[model samples]
Target: MTEEIEAQSFEEEDVEFFEFKQFNKNALSVQLDTDTVYPEVIPPYPSLLAISNTYGYFVAATNEGFIYASTQDLHELFDNSEAGSKELLSQKIHFEISEGKVRCLRLSSDQLTLIVVVEGGLVLFYDVTKFASEKAGCQPFQIMTFPDDIRDLRPNPGEKYNLIAILLVSGIVYIKDYLLNNEISKIEGSKVGERFTAMCWSQKGKQIICGNHLGQLMQYTPEGTHKSSIQPPQELQQHYVQNVLWLESALFVVAYFPVIQEDDSELDVFIISRETKSKTLYIKSPTICSQISSDHPKLPYLYMETIKDWGPNLKCLIICASANSADINLIARDESNNWTSLNLSDTTRAALPLSEVNDEDTLPVGLALDFTCMESWITRLTADENTEVPPVPILYILNNECDIVAYRCFHKDAFFVDESFSGMSPPQKLPVTGHSSGMTLPKRDLSHSTTSTQNTTVLSAPIKTESPITDPIETGSPIVAPIKTASPVFAPIKTASPVVAPIKTASPVVAPIKTASPIIAPIKTASPMIVPTKSGISNNSLSSSISYDKNISSQKKIRTPPPDSTPSRNLGSNQPTEADSKTPHMIRMNATNNEINELHNLIEELENSYIAKYHDRTTEQCFDNPDAWLIGDLPVITSEINRLEHEASSMSQALADLRRQVNEFSHDVHIDYVKTTKDIEHLMYTPSTITVGRRGILQSRIKERLETTFKVGCYINFQRLFVYTNLYLCL
Candidate 1:
């Protein structure tokens, strides 16, 4: 009973392990709409997608031949913020291909060049940095035309030269220096029915590994010299290799066997050691096949994370997307280097139901794997002092229905802390370092201080009293600076109340100070008499007083507006008048009117040009014959219709003739078959009719019958049949 219980627990643990490794489809998903953000029209069926390595920016192409490059980080789609979503939807670069629809897009590792493959075997090389910064102009710096359509282009991983491997639809590979516009070498498939289906460059770009439809992996140097080849094992014989990836010591080959039922087809992955040229491991996975034709087969997308310190052998998780299903599979290796796979079809179905009327969507059209964004997201999610956060790739799957779903391939529990441990310790507070973080001090009222200083300076300027002004000093304590006397005659006196009456009655002195600058000039000239006699102020207070005095002196230097301009200043500060507010409205109205006039002129020009051209063409056509004008090209249309009818009649008559000939041939064959069958039957029945006696007579009769029935060119053997009949009669 205990053993059974332990086995059940082990099974449950295995279930949990798979649950954690599966992709969480519900975490993030967003549908892309071109109309919402861009002025250009992009159809719903996006054909190509390419993502950058640094920022999570991507470029997408539509079937209508429109390509859009995003300006904002695609990772913002995870937050679901309105502003970020809007920014992410907006495109910075728009390119229209006039040749044909874009088939493939490859962004270089350094993110410098963007390689675009269109129909008709045209390859365009664009300067991504220039177009992205300029935000205008859709011209490629370099264009190369090929004889066949390009299947894929891979930039070299080495930093030696700007070299790229171009794979054509006819199973030919070319190593070219795109910068120099030179073809270095060309690698062609074998003459005995072998063609490359998928290819990848080595780590240092020293070699290229290509997979063919015959389940063979071929390696070649950058100079196009054949290095080695690895054939598939017995179980994977006659399989079509879909993709090949070389990571460190192992070469991963993804191959699938063709079957009538696509759903029953198994995807096989073989891991081979590059050093020994031997197979190390094999894996089989069930996958849903796409409805695409075999003539233009698409290889599965494979992404492997940069292996760190997981193990001595292959250690990173491999993510594969075959573009045949909405879900992806994760192939990982444990510490023991054992390979295992987990499928996320069930999770995807649960998250995105296919039964909903509007939710009916196609399989993934493109897959983008980003490790930079996923690492940052994992860091933020597992910020609660958790160190065991698993490294997973951030995969963005774009479907035909314009929806982009993000997958993390791991459970949230890996980044979640237990509730029991959460309450054990309080959250640590981050140290405040900036000035904006600490307590704020109240602002000093500089306006009020300046007004009080002006009043003090004016009152002391006109006063002729011998006693020093000390009564106003107590009232000005809030003002940091002390007041100065206008003359040295009253500098020695310290009486506080002698000038109180004069100061109150000196209202007439303010008029001159406000009207004439010469009367208040003593305030600036008496700076030597403004020394502080009090010793109770602290150093801070004194420093603040000096600053205040400097501010007051600076304000005095500024030219103040006259009283005559006070009404204008008041009108500016208060609500605007009718005429003042109408100024901007009038300007806007005039600008709009100008724009309308310009548009009207442009439309009129276009209309006149079109009418003139139409009239000219019509006149030219009617010049030769007057009847052509009245008929308006009816005879041309009739001729086209008659030609089509004649072709159809000829095709029908030929088909009838072929049918009659087939019938005549079949009749002749049937008559010959009946004659041959009767001849063979006559030979067998004539022998059986002979009795046991009269062996000589029977032999002579059988020989005579065989010779007459079967001549030299007859179907039956006369001599053998006669001998057999004679022997039977004797017995």
Candidate 2:
């Protein structure tokens, strides 16, 4: 109970309950190497495995590399307009860098670089607009150092190359150039026990890819050579690859694997595709299993992107985390381009934040109802479209203790609502676009355009829908940008057109690719079955299009047809259709039958208010409220009713000392049965009184057959009945 009201407010100020302990002893005297002697602690709340934002700053980094950052303006601390600050999101220390622990932070997508890395192999980098315009702290004017530690670093998909890549821990690979401070190419691993774990870049940063642990995937060249490998997926062998992404004709990846033949481990994903070089799976999770039965089932955070105004060609999305729930799964992509996933944590529970919306001062840390890592970026300001504000999309979650929140994400393709066209009128202001189609706009303001109280602009658009796919330059097309390819270029394999068709019998291509076209779309043929991975996964009745096809180096073979030879969405209408009967498939079934008739009149007004206010209460007039108890629940119910009335007066003096030891054991068993019947009537002639000492009558016929065979074998060895009556009188 809040530690008994904080030990009764530290015993009403007599104070003596101060044991706070999180001593990193000044981060172990700023440790450099020396293996450590003792004092190190620091987990008073640590685990935040990587997060990185931009556009009015955001940086979390923890697992002990500590980091923090956020001096306001994250869209005014995620749209509440900082509500008179006191900690909507204050956090400070951009870096208390006591040597290696952080592992990864990575911001740069022109938010002007961040990086970090750590785990004893260094790397650092920072310059995030000169550490938020010199409010300084996480000092790293570029470092680097590696003797083998750093595991994954990436960067270099386009900004004309200040390059990065890295990977290390003895499986080697470098690319470096942390803006020309050296090493522009190293690579390694053509075999001799290849290790490599995961890489990205692709064919514009001039190629790279990687993956290895064992579930192979390779390919490289930013001057390091190697190239073609793949193979992966006999259900991803022993697994390992953990995240890859270059999704522009596909590489994606993910991996981790684990299911040692099923005691529940799984984490899959796959894709591959440089135009059907074929790999596919895409998203897996089924046996999630881990609510701490000795915790194991790995794999969380995935994140994807490829957007294009939530519609026509180039959709992707992805956004992961939810092995089972504090929510976060989004996924998207399907008018046959496939992908799905959903849960976007219930459209972010109507935007969440004031530290989970007014729980009355609770979060100092301790938030694992879901989301242990999430990062979605893209900030673009540019307002004055009559003072606009409706783009939404922010994200940044991270919970299992590292705390960090910041929501605003809402997606039904940017605010969808048409439950039967409610229109009681008024509600139509919709121009929302923070980087829509080729992204690149982060110079702060991040336009949440005034107005605050946070649902950051509620459903914002579809009042009666005069075509609102949420503006990628208002649909007819002017917002272009997408193809920043380093490897998702795909469309060249038409072996005679058919990669599993049936999107209402295929037809719509309409040619839409040129706003700086590097050839974007073309992968659309859906229905190869396997969709159902749960959590919402919507489609609203598939009809989407745009598949571009700029001849992506053809490598055909995608045929899969026999699911009863296709053809059906009522193959040419079996009747019905007048715009699908005035578009109201029961409008959420009459708002779920008026919420099931107000839950049957709210269960008969809560059963007549429990029969007119707590029915005939019994149990001492229903616990005769001494001010309704709970000041420590009435001192634990008056010390358990004085410990059950001193255990019923010591169980009534132990039932009078067990009835005086059962009346002295029944008066010593009736005086030892009357002194053994007067000592067997004073041993009066029992057992033929005349002792057969001389064994008369030939030992009395062997002592009467040895006393009738020792009384019929209920044998007592009185020296074996006197040696069986002297062996039956020495027969």
Candidate 3:
């Protein structure tokens, strides 16, 4: 390895490049009408799906499987309304279920009907408000069919909640939710008979799974009871179960994959057992290199992806939500790795001080689920905004040479970013914490599935292809939510490794990169190798590093910045000129590193975009230094700033070893204040007694004795005053 290139190299010293990049609010492109708003949305594809913001109108699914109902976040809520303000409506639905593109879309949490699952088969259902809000597409008011041709769809559990389940494609799986004979229900009967390729709904929903192809899973319960049957142990399900997830009740993780391939198809990860019929083991099947799934529920951290023995084939993605789900934030691509957030909770088996374990408080083994997909799985998980904690999870990962990342799994406590910056500072809008502790995520003893065998896991929808992203990494395993409490909760699926083939119905259809984009960035280095500060720099600044390797190797002096906009994207009149914007940035810098990893597959092309939406406080943009890694999911704050810089460097080295093991020192940590001198000769000889309230002292007990002797004004993390001074409460 005679290579130290340490003599010095970073040089792009032409700093004068700024004119239009100035509109930075972090990122906001907008622009939509993909044909009068979302007219069945289908402009391009390979994977970039999601829509259904529950009720205030919104719904979607497209890639040629067609379905749309909007109010904007559904991908077409335009506003030009003649200029006088408001307008976001988008509707297009006459119910077209030929099933070839659409991979997943569900909206039952009562916003009324809308489900579309086509990878090649079908499951279409739509209503978009049945008739008028001003009509958008309204048709098929209800059309159903599924014994096995679907491929992943979901909706079960609280909040306006409704009901939905399907994942067939010959892997046979179904759940329907209601309305049997006349439509909607498909008459139950399929339970474990085998054929499910992915399913999920075990956050305690009393049985709703299917994983088949023979590797098995097959649970059922809408009251027709069939609950029981799990496999994967005849040498890893022999192949099948593309994705399924659920993380905090126990285990039922599956990413499986082995139906046949030769050089790099090996993925694996399974932990199943929502009560009984077991399976366990994780993290050794070639040490997972990419993963994601925690679409936020407050930091349930999971993300890791790597590959770079030397260069060019580079590959990056790292973040497994650190800062106390214990150790995870390890990205690399030659940038080395580390950004630790270690403490894997188990407060003797976590009971919510909101515990998260794998190490902290030791006590291992709970909510277990062994995994396998030969290489990696789990590609999206998010939740965060103190909905109490479990919902701030963000994970999206994949790597062999492809990248898609987005990460951040909770870690704030400077009393939760100073009481959430004192109720969001200034004026006052407050109201954020509504408590969803979400089964506090870190508990797993495993045993579920026996309220007459009710286990669950489904992943459906598997049509992928939007590659062009950056950071995030590996599986954490715990998902168990439909929980009204029978315990059994294991469902995992965050996929990648698609090949499928066969589809050319003549070409010309394109849309699928609408939003959720960030392909993981804030790039990782969670371990060791990072070198490039351009190595060191000198030979007379190597002529400014050969003018930044000749401004990133001149395509005529690296200058193609225009076109952040001008409204010129024709795609076909055969328009894409300027030599098609210098060919995907020169085929994204000379392709191959597996097609320059499809220019960073941010889970199939920048799902809605991001640099940091971050949310809550309103505006705090900065980003530090990002050039690429944009595809949605990337916020495991360098293992939570390496767990608050290792607890502020172990609290400044335990206050400098407690002032060098002092012989005389006190431990009070003071901050007291009690001012009040209202004249009248100081209130007639200081006799001020105003205690007509609850016995005597209470203004939250003198602001907890002057904010615990003055540590007031700033705090949002000693676990939010551990119940106001360790649980004695105001007194």
Candidate 4:
């Protein structure tokens, strides 16, 4: 993949370079720890891993039960080009259990104890520092075996003692001291038979909380005393809690349940506040993509890639799993203060040239399990102030091929950018709405109508305009329509060769309407305007009239009046004067012109209303298309129905085969029971016939030990009688 990246030709859409890259090639590799002894057979790959933010170290437990540790230089990895060139400094830690695979690995925040759990119920606790030292040797400091498999382990958040909490598969949780082999307490789960699947320590470490298979949450003190129990809401009664985390003042739980459909699944996230228990936020699976787990062989699990509070205090929860593309779901709050799930698929798609294989399969497989980010914040203010782009935390992704790629989120919206950090320049804060300004203005939807003119050839010669006369609309009243003017006659420009004829100057359009205070600028066109000069001058005056005002000459005018229309309004009144109405004999000179003015006003209102409606429909379509298609889940529903039908057929066949096997086993057990009874009956009769057992035993002993004198004398009488009888029979 790395070779392909370097050689592949990218189209315009593909991003050739990324802001993020892996700091070290050996950061997650077992090969970096050369001193560690591997098993004779092929070693198991890492099933669980974790990285320490403070110490820049990582501990990973492979399936073969080998624990590999590495001391990483985060700066070197995150900086620039030097990251991949350097090898990671590492050490290998060994333990007594060499058989079963590792199940879970967790490290304390203080880096004191490394908790290790393997398959087969074995739990090993190690001192963080000594375990990494060569002199301390390879054995765990303390070990315990549970009756059932260990599901999850969490270190006590309490600063007082170095304690760890382990959840067993048998609905029990144990809080114990890591240093001293002492069991502080054992707390039974809420239900008798249900297992505790998820557990976490309180923010202050004063309490331990665990979620059970029955969807019940229980809190316990360090000494195994029950503090409180929380039953899930009625809607979530059937769902099981898969993961629980104590993030700040909230208990975040990821719960899932199988639907009635053969393979369909649903997931819900419940965030319950510690301060106010009633304050709860429930989120269903987001509709960013289709159901990712619908066709998966295994159900979806929330694998925490990393949790960061970057860019001031923007809490970022990065989750990477098969359910959400390998890019991870960047779950964060949107601008509206609503929890929004942003998929990194689009971000990664733009940054990397992924294969054309099925994205669902290609995304989650063989990617790096551990991801970390810098402590720095890139706040909104900082982003706005910096002439250069704000330094965002780079996301490093490692694939199975060992090729690493990096990506950074693009700041495309003000709300999308982190708002935590302050700006370099002291921000001149603007007053929020409804704060300093108590006065409010109503919002109105305003639309503008643009009139386009027909294209025509340019005369190539500049025309002059006479001094413009200023006329203001009457005060205290609104003007309904623009005053009409006569059209200008075109005078041909003499040229050597005319490539194209001059364009026809269209009628002018009305100026846009303004609110409250209105200033109207007259519409001017490419052709000159002819003002009536007291004389009955030919329409030639229209071409010769030039404006003296420089502003009037420079303004590109829109023709407002319809062609061949007579002048309507007078200079001083709302209505056109009688003299302007007199026209050619064929025109209706007798009709009252007031009706014409009313009709024109009505037509203008109708045009404005049509334009407003057009804009509203366009806006509605933009928002409606996605909601109807995406939220409807049509594509996902179709695919799920097909997949479920196939799964149903397979499960039915398997169930039938299982039933047949059970019947056969039952028949064999019945035959064995009858045979045993007959043997017992025969043995009872044989016992009654064994009255000469002592005599028979004596004869057998004399024959067996005849070679020994003591033994032969002891049985001489019995042996002589047998010998005499044998001799008489022979004679």
- Shift in Å, residue 420, candidate 1: 23
| Rank list by lDDT | 1, 4, 2, 3
Tens-digit lDDT track of model 4 for 1-731: 11111111111122212223222222322122333322213111222555554444555443344444442343344332343242333334544346365666676656555677766566665555554443335445445555466667777766844688877766678776654334567777544446676777877888877887777777788898887766665565566666666666454545444323245454555544443444444444442222334243344445444344444333544443432333344455323334445543342331222422344222322223232343343323343573334434344343222223444443333224534322222212112221112211111111111110111122322222222224322211112222221222111112221111111222322222222223333433445432212111111111122223334432233334455545444222433335534554213422323444455478679768766755554555543355554432443445657999999999999999999987885575445434433433333445455446543553344334333323324344235434533432221
Error of 3 at 426 (Å): 48
Which run of 10 residues does model 1 get worst, by summed lDDT? 4-13
Candidate 3 per-residue lDDT, tens place, 245-357, comes to: 54434444455666674334434544443442243323212222222222221211122222112222212222222111322323222233211112223211111111122
Pairs with backbone N, CA or C atoms under 3 Å apart (clashes), candidate 2: 203-486, 248-488, 248-489, 249-488, 249-489, 249-490, 326-369, 326-370, 522-547
- The deviation in Å at residue 223 for candidate 4 is 2.3
Q: Is candidate 1 or candidate 4 better by TM-score?
A: 1
TM-score of each: 0.47, 0.22, 0.21, 0.44
Error of 3 at 374 (Å): 36
The global C-alpha lDDT for each of the candidates, from Candidate 1 onward, is 0.48, 0.42, 0.33, 0.43
Flag the better candidate by lDDT, 1 or 2: 1
User: Which wins on lDDT, candidate 1 or candidate 3?
Assistant: 1
Q: Where's the lowest-lDDT run of ten residues in candidate 2?
A: 3-12
TM-score of 3: 0.21
What are the per-residue Cα lDDT tens digits for candidate 2 across 1-731?
A: 11111000001111111111111111101111122111123222122333332234346555445444442333343444333332334445445566646656665445366777666455666555444344544355445555456666767766645677877756677786664344546776776657786677863677878777776667777778776765565545577666566666464535455425464444566554444444243344332212222233323334333333343332554454432223333444555655434332231231212223324221111111112213322322225332222333444444433444544333332223311111112212212221122221212111111100100111211111112121121111221212222222222112122111212332322222333213323323342222111111111001111232436322232233343455434534434345543546434434444554465577678768755543344334544676764343443466668999999999999999999987885575446434433433323434355345532543554445445445644244334445544444432
CA shift at 278, candidate 2, in angstroms?
Answer: 24
